[model samples]
Target: MAAAPTRIRAAVVGTGAIVSGSHLPALRALADRVDLVAAVDVDEERLAAFRALAAEPDETGPGFTVTGYTDLAAMLDAERPDLVLIGTPPSLHRDQTVAALRAGAWVLCEKPLCLTLAEYDEIAAAENPDGGPYASVVFQHRYGSGAVHARDLLTGGALGAPLVAHCQTTWYRDTDYYAVPWRGRWDSEGGGPSMGHGIHQMDLLLHLLGDWTEIRGMAGRLVHDVESEDVSTALVRFANGAMATVVNSVLSPDEVSRIRVDCADATVELTHLYGHTNDDWVYTPAPHTREAADRVAHWRTPAADLPSSHAAQLSVLLDAMRDGVRPPGSGPDARRTLEFIAALYKSAFTGRPVHAGEIAPGDPYYEAMHGGHPDWAPAAATAATSATAATSAKEQ
Candidate 1:
């Protein structure tokens, strides 16, 4: 008889909305496979609340009690968990992720992994190459049943060649939303809507479309008084000759997150705001091409409705941990999404198109999303706003 897989000892950092809403629920559901060891948050009250949500003693067997800490270092030392979930702000991600990887714990962090590619590299460099611990960013949409079936169709050329596409994440983020200290800052939250809000749709687009060749775009602070662009638009050209227009915005009252890929023989699309099931996807074959229509119509899809969410992606990550394999969205797979955003910002700031592999080791954009100096670019007015905010705080 086969032996049972060892349960993972898990510690979660940040007891904020994402943790309480998604991470905790998923962890509790898998109580048998995960041991909740510790939770860390700056807010003691929030940490206490998260600790209460830990599974009852019967959930994970007897004598199970979760520890709460207001400091990360103390928790890492005392708990020594195998998996760490980082739901902290963007600025904290680099240091926290690096610390976890160095301590031989695997990590699945919230998105916009860090403020810059350099910091991204730092986290990647800290991973265990001899193959014990690793880190994965959260891009859950890439793992759903609809996405898998769509990839099978495109990769097999059933939809012919992918020619063009459109991806949009138009949502609303008002002044009240950015009232939080970290919301709109480059150093903390990363780029505004593109980094925080629309990253889900954008990452899904990259997953389906594959490698990009060149991209150019612009960012605007239009409506919100935040320190980052509330809206960003870009034109992207893929390595496979596919072109796409991408937009990430928080100014739309009628929020919709959508992606459409037009192939030589058919068009495939997905539309959903926060999460999506296979029902949100649609495929349309060219009217004149009978073979193409039949091929798409007969394409097989998963029997399950597997939707996009933290839970869905965590399932895949857990499997990797159990099997001693690198988790999905790890290293370069996750880095590509962040790289795309950097290239878009570089283009927007430089007033010229930027290509993949353009921002290398020494490139200022590679070091920071706002470049080495935010004020160097006119589009990055947030630098001035941040400075003004800091000044006002000092005066007060």
Candidate 2:
């Protein structure tokens, strides 16, 4: 008998609008490497619509088959997917990811992995000991070509000892954007610009510059009538002695996301428009020797048809799944990022600076800050309560 073909069985949870816009499309792009067997969502209607969309004839290229499920547990029990994509909101990420991991499935969870550091710690501790079915957080910007190039420069010692790092994400979010009941809520989405929007840039900053030692942050509800901050700024101290200033806001008229790193030898800067397409990345290295200047000049020519960060990360993740190895941007990687967010929130609330190692498992605020009753929109609250009651009755 012929040996069985190797296939990376995959499933996606949370068929929210983003699942279609980001995760599904990326999965479609990696169709051959992955078998997208199941999609799970709480909303049956949304799941049905997504199934239709997934089944739609691909005018662009070949299509793969996918099944839909309204129950996550049912999908996991039936499909036994090799990899699971958790695209749920930040608040639900901890529970969903833990459930999937415990159910013997690898997970690629969306960002802001958890709402609080303690929750992040709990999820991180649940990883399989044998390293089968690992989990990764989706910090896609770290996979971008420009970011790759920057990392090469930094790692190659071309820019010696990064002295200063700066990141800015200024994207516009109108009233209509926040019209969604859970859009700007602290309990539901975790936080506003910092956790939801700025996290990508912050991840990139930390990934390149190394871990941060201390952070002092301030957040404010400048524009939106939400419980969380609409604008946030943080001063970060990296373990390598590099310092960084990060600013995130949802009030800007035009979208601009960019980063600049000043090193002992030279300065490297990257500027790109929001949504991360259109060959918009600009990398400028400070002039050093004539040879270095010429090299920088050579790199300045425009390149075409670069993969989106999401696509790049997805490809890497699929390869890792197939190889049964830990992928880049692994769950631990995302957990560290969430730890920073938790520290930032602590700093914001307490009006003090927070250190990375300070958020230990035994900390009083760790578990108390998250879990228990959720802070959500009235409609969501009612629905959640009803669902909880129904589940209790079913279990009884």
Candidate 3:
């Protein structure tokens, strides 16, 4: 047998919530294959906290010895890490990812990837053409056993052609949640739930349904007093002639993250919030045929229960790194999801159905998801003012 691959040296940037809660845990779980070498954060307190957290021993092994840095460049230069985990805000993803890639380190960045298609291209440009140092988006939902099984079935005609689907990501985020300075702004957080919260479900939808052909969407600032919309809805048409409805909201009391696909032979559904296991998926056969029922018996997820999480995706990324190949969530595979998000925003703001390949280099949407629409926030403000005045008059 070939020799076991050497342990990969890894570092993390932004010791914020995502790093502490998600990425760090993932790194520790894969300790046998990776070394948590360093961490970077602007805040000294958070950096120190991360260093302490990294040193905590787990049941399987001892902890890591991670050096802390206030500057990413300093960490990159000093450590010369093989992998870099970026958990910063969406606005900073492009620059930071580019920086890591340029430093000859592979990158796995958190979702939203970047603010626009143009920025995504910039990140892609920084990669080595030979495929050693690539930047991947952290879309862990696609790595789940349920999703993998579903995508195989859907694409292989096991469930027949997907006809109609619904992708919903409705979760509550109150005033205190958006109290953070970067939570609600367009420049900081990118778009609303459509870009931030719903993108995960949307990416999973695309992963199962294949490429999307067109999108017609609408967004509104229904509840939140912020620069971005609190709720958004869209109708998407897939290249396979299937259509889907997508609803993303942060104002719903009954929170749910669900995707249901109605195929010609049967229906497959996944219902959960944030993450899901194989048990969360249901495969229902069409009542009209016995063959559909028979296939349902074989249409099952892997026996092992691997919930969709950062660890699952990170494990795959580690394998790819060992082999020196491009990994999932990199290059075109990652760009497809971000492109769909850009199209949704363009269609919502422009009030037109956006088709694939339409938002090219020069299009405003290519530069930013909002497309720099001058009327984006003003339109919502106008409606809110009108509603408030009408309510006041009725009270008088």
lDDT of 3 by residue, 263-341 (tens): 9988899999989999999988888645654566777646567889999999999988877788988888778988998
Q: Judged by lDDT relative to the true structure, which candidate is superior, 1 or 3?
A: 3
Superior candidate under TM-score, 1 versus 2? 1
Best by lDDT: 3
Candidate 2: tens digits of C-alpha lDDT, residues 1-396: 112137678788988877777877777777767767899988989888888887765643345578888888888888887778888877888888888888878788888777777777677677764555667888888776666766777777766778998989988899998988877875778778888898888888888887889999887778788867788888999998999998999999988888888887667676775445425545455556435866666344434435455667878877766666678787666667777877776676667899987877645335433222233223554465567667878999
Native RMSD of candidate 3 (Å): 7.4
Every model's TM-score: 0.90, 0.85, 0.92
lDDT of 1: 0.82
What's the best-to-worst order under lDDT?
3, 1, 2
- Pairs with backbone N, CA or C atoms under 3 Å apart (clashes), candidate 1: none
Best by TM-score: 3
lDDT of 3: 0.87
